[model samples]
Target: MDAPACAATAAQAASLQALLNTYLREMAPGSAVLADDRSTVEIPLSHIPARLRVRITYFSATGPHRFGPAQILFDGSSTWHSAPPVQVLTLIAQECFTRLNSRDAGQLPEFLRGLFNSNAGIEQNLIRHAGTPEPDGFLAAEQALTFGHWLHPTPKSRDGLTTWQQAAYAPEYAGEFRLTFFAADQSLVTLGSAHQAPADMLRQIPGLDGAFRLRPDEVMIPAHPLQAQMLRLDPQVQALLATGRLRDLGEAGCAFNATSSLRTLYAPGCRWMLKFSVPVRLTNSLRVTKHNELETGVLMARLLKHLDADGPRFRILNDPAYLTLTLPGRSESGFEVIFRENPFAGTDGTGIYNLAALTADPLPGRTALLTRLIQQLAADHGETPADTARLWFEAYLTCMLDPVLDLYDRHGIALEAHQQNSLLDLSTGLPSRGYYRDNQGYFIAQDALPRLNALEPSLTQQPALVYPRAHINERMAYYLVVNQIFAVIRRLGCDGLAPEPDLLLQLRRRLTTAASRLSGAGADFARYLLTAPALSAKANLLTRARNVDELETEAQEGLFLQMPNPIAAAQPQPVQERTDVLT
Candidate 1:
């Protein structure tokens, strides 16, 4: 194979190995082969009894290693070599099914295909990004995620997109396309907004030229290109079109580039980011907007507006408006689109990056944005890389964790602050602020409803959105603690800036201090996080293997496994005097 092909194969194999290793550790703990020093361990495959060597990392039990370029082997011996990633995954799946006496082994082939497609998507994205001149800092960071979620088995998979469509709409490829617009009669449109009417919001968006002017009785709504095609075939949409209630305006306005979230698009000079409901399944769930989610967005915006009275440390990128068709019996028409506040509108010098993309490994041999930022900080301050890493992490925790916990403790609002939904704004290589987006993932605790209702009376109408305190803690523990913070610690370690244990120790110190300053439930939660024996992490591999739609599963109901808490495991050290790292 050629060099590029060989690299792609290696990436696929590495992803598969990561998934399998997670499964073995969680599902069959006794299968691991540990070294005397515990720095390196091996997992003996049940199907072949041959060990696959892995290097140890923080939080998780294992990290990636190079057995060979594209093939996995038993130790350094060439005698026992496994096939490609797909075949290896199939073998592991077969063994897992046989062990559990489950019949869902059939799902393995589909997941394997997804893995291949994901690899292809990454390859295409790399080629496109290499050929294209770099974009602005924020957009470049947004589109830089080639290989997606480090833990997901098929992070780059676009299940229903064709190769051409993938090139035109996938964010990694820097895809840009005109959004398809439709004119719906005023009577058929359901509008919701926290600030302005949905129709007014649509009218204010630039680049919708006079050629696509709306009539007095019609309201404009935008749809993704693929979603537009799907809408044309939908019975409800066709019925409305047949009755002259909905008019197809075709594709119009300026080209919008897809962001990291495939359905969300960004247009230069536009005041709002458009998030459309696409029917295609990406990763674990179909990208469709439900009515409740729209309602939740408006509610969240109102709550944030109330919270903003007391100067929030982080900004909530609110989805202020949504446009959707209101069919007689159908709650959602699959053409729902949200108008989210655009923070990048006027800031040309500042850098805003999706936290997930920032932490991801960049192209081979290239330093990731996080690593580059740390190196630059070290150079600027004349500090060691390790010290810079510790300082940078301190600032990050202060900016990110404090606000997240404050919201949960004070208002009962638990954000889905996973890496993808969270963003960090950096000023001169230091974290200046943090932002959290996504309306579908916010959770409100039942205990805080009265306070929230006092702030916004309409919030009490949807009691189902409220969850128990324990449930919120679990979700927050996974997303904020396990997936977000620990992932950053691991990345810093992997990049050689600092050892993972040192970072964990620093994090524990910070959390301990924060906990002392906090009160009530927040203080207890912070203390728990600092010394929890184990943490609940989403089991992405097992979740995908079960062919479950994560969105459908409740936050607490999805597959979870206990990962040893690095903070808890670290030995206590003398507390150092805190410095003004934020400066």
Candidate 2:
């Protein structure tokens, strides 16, 4: 590749850097972050007609850790000598390794290669993994390294050519990658001619590329074929009195509750949703596991992380009670106490099995943007076929509630955010609205609060009373943000609403505009809590939680909310065949 192409790649990546950061922060927070001086992000790369500007970092594009510690340097020119790695390589590798033995045509070599070639590092792995040991070092494991240049055949096909050569010409593969050498430890230490990274540079990054850190605890709703193979041996569970498999983290009074939100709930470290909450029924105690609680923490962290970052889908949740609790049952594994506030106070209602209704329709959220949500989400992302551009507007809400539980637990901080008292939105599945119905308010124990006085501290009016830290944050974002003033554009990303940019930009404008009208929610409410200054810094980690089982999120059209009136939706009319063939 030439300098211009490299520069273009850099430019494209740079231009969209802010946009991507904004989106990622909202979608996944643990991984999305800014550079030291806030100049770059982990995914700092671009593609142009000729060259690509690159940042060589030890990042897994598709792995659970999106932004691990990066060297944070750039490869000024696109050194074509070695393979050109795309920014999303690591993630692709993680996903590929995850889907290595899958039966889906969508995950075959050709498709996998496309995602991998996008990341230079992954392509190197592809080369190394495919090689065989030679007398000197190694030989091409499979002689003749014929990769993406020609489509690989899958087991499902017999009329092979139909699936290969006919593939659309979009330069389907990513940056080029050839064979590379791995050290005794299977690290990408040595490379052949295509080694663009110099020895010194290579030594700097070393071989932590595939380093094992934290295992992901995701629940797979439709259990991907490869996910089954990735489940590691279950870890021992932890509780106040005893220990066993994570599934057994409770004593006599543990709740065996569950959720159906997560698409995948069986990821190694994140499998069950049994130990986090107060025990409702004790009979199902044996069914809980550690994987369950871990997933809950992950989910909560993701939720709060998004709110802490800047995004168009900001939720006005102030409760930080969303964290991995060490209670009995599975709730202990995952975080507990989801804050029901504006935004996430709703559901997508995209039920368990809607294959028939989902036939020719694109993404349901994008399709119903106009009627489903505010006018903003419908306007963003473009008007392509629905299936082509789908975003999880429901995710925006689930993410909101899940985070409050996250922040509190991580800090060993607890807030009063009971689900029964919380309000959730069930309005249009994708397009919905959630608010602190009656401002039930955030609560803290009589003596353990005040740590966040800088945020909002005042002497407790009543004896032993403490301040509600989470509530303070909520009022700032909700009343001061989405409501109170109309200047800020509602950053609601409901599909078919205006594009995300317009909505967020408008939110900023409106937030500043109506900054003064937010006193109705209450002012002194936050100043009354106490802090648990004496609590130990080290928290007892939990293990027996699991994710909620996948259930029918999809429901009747009006399941989420009641319709103002039963207005009949017009069905699509068939179009007549065109007779212009002769003309």
Candidate 3:
């Protein structure tokens, strides 16, 4: 390659190295060696034993940094060469497989390819987003995530999607298309909901016509285009088509754009967002809606409705309805679709942003939406950014943390409130309301099972939906604290908007205050959070290295590594405090 091409390659490799370094720090802390000043880090290659080491400049421990080209060291000297990110990851995976004496090493290449493809998709998405006219409120926020997860090895990896398919279906690519419709006989369809049936909602879509003639006992439903193609090849679907039990009505209705969750589609005019079950491998799982998930959605809606008779502190985007066809000899329907209530429907200019997207880096030459919002808030309040950050962080706690803890402490409902699953309704650039989505992620404590069953008797029969208090608390610690809240703090520090130590202090104080107000298992969990020496961090790279299916694996079964607790490290003392501690 020429000089300019070589420089470009080195820069690309550095970007990948930065991503890998972040993942290693979070998931495999043993691999990193930090300097006393916390200004430099050396990561030894696990696959190559001690033959090579990756050295880079480090800023705050948990915040994003300005990483230069990773230097390749051979023996004890610099080789003056840089390894591409995929090469580094491949070496790590090879080492892991060798150490475990496992036979799944073959899967690493496929994952590497997916990672490369994902990077290309991200690059293209950013270019597209920059060139296109800026979309309005929620849509703009939703499409802003050029890079998905900072800690995941391949956050945007989609193995099954072709180039055209990614352009049409990936949320980051701003994909918009009408859903493919399918008609199933009433007897062969399973429907459940808190309000109108799935069939009724489908029949009411305005300007939807020419798909098929719906019989009195038949109903129309939507399917993802890719998933619809897969279903056509199924023997059962073929038999149903031959028997006139199911009809391929083709694509019809208004175009709905893909959300951050690629399988979920949002149409501004529709009353509900449609989440379909796509069999494509996205991130760590095949995006398929299980039978239990459909049932759990209805159950959770009823429970939340019963609990929040007056009004709820946090809004739950209820999965009110689902439609799926029942094929003979099939254990579960893979074409299931969940109809989630659209909270942003007919909005009065209240901007709702997915918390994850808001925190992500904006396109080139643009500030992050959250950072810009904070600056605007500071300008309005005549305060510094730090002061506004503190205020905004506090209000965010009241809106998010308070309600999440209340649900767990009082109701034994543990929401998987990761960054992506949580939404913030911003009023004047500060969080005024919070919404938690994803019915498949709810975990009801066993103690609350009886109460939940009292509301919906069928819940007891769903063994996969409930767990012990300890298990629920563990999940809560990882999702709510480690992934969601800490991510926000990291972003603030990375952008120089707020010092991480100060933010950690504020977080600890808020948790302490909330703990004092709670009782029983919730209080116990709160105390644990404040006092625990280390929190469990998800081992995404290690999990992917092992070729595990995340959706099928139990939460406990997922790989975890101990990450030093920033809250504990940030505890204030009577004497003058030092801010050099890395957490």
Better of 2 and 3 by TM-score: 3
TM-score of each model, in listed order: 0.92, 0.26, 0.91
Tens-digit lDDT track for model 1 on 1-583? 7657756665665566556555655566676666687565555665564545545442333232223322347545776454566565666665655555665556656767776777777666665554444333677777888777767767777777887877778887776788899998998888788888876666656767575867899888889998998999998789888998899999777778888888998876788899988867777777888787888888888888987722345877899788888877677878789889887864652578778877776665467768887887888888887788888887788778888888777777888788888888776577778888888777788878888889888787776578887777777888887778877887788788877777888887777887888775566667878777887887776777677776677542358887777788887777565575534
**Top lDDT model:** 1
Superposed Cα deviation of residue 391, candidate 2 (Å): 19
Clashes of each: 0, 125, 0
Q: Candidate 2 deviates by what RMSD?
A: 23.6
Per TM-score, the best of the predicted structures is 1
TM-score rank order: 1, 3, 2
Instruction: TM-score winner between 1 and 3, please give it.
Output: 1
Q: Which ten residues in a row have the lowest lDDT in candidate 2?
A: 535-544
The list of candidate 3 runs beyond 4 A from truth reads 1-19, 26-28, 46-66, 76-105, 132-136, 209-212, 309-313, 346-350, 554-557, 573-583
Off by over 4 Å in 2: 1-502, 505-515, 520-583
Model 3 lDDT vs. the true structure? 0.73
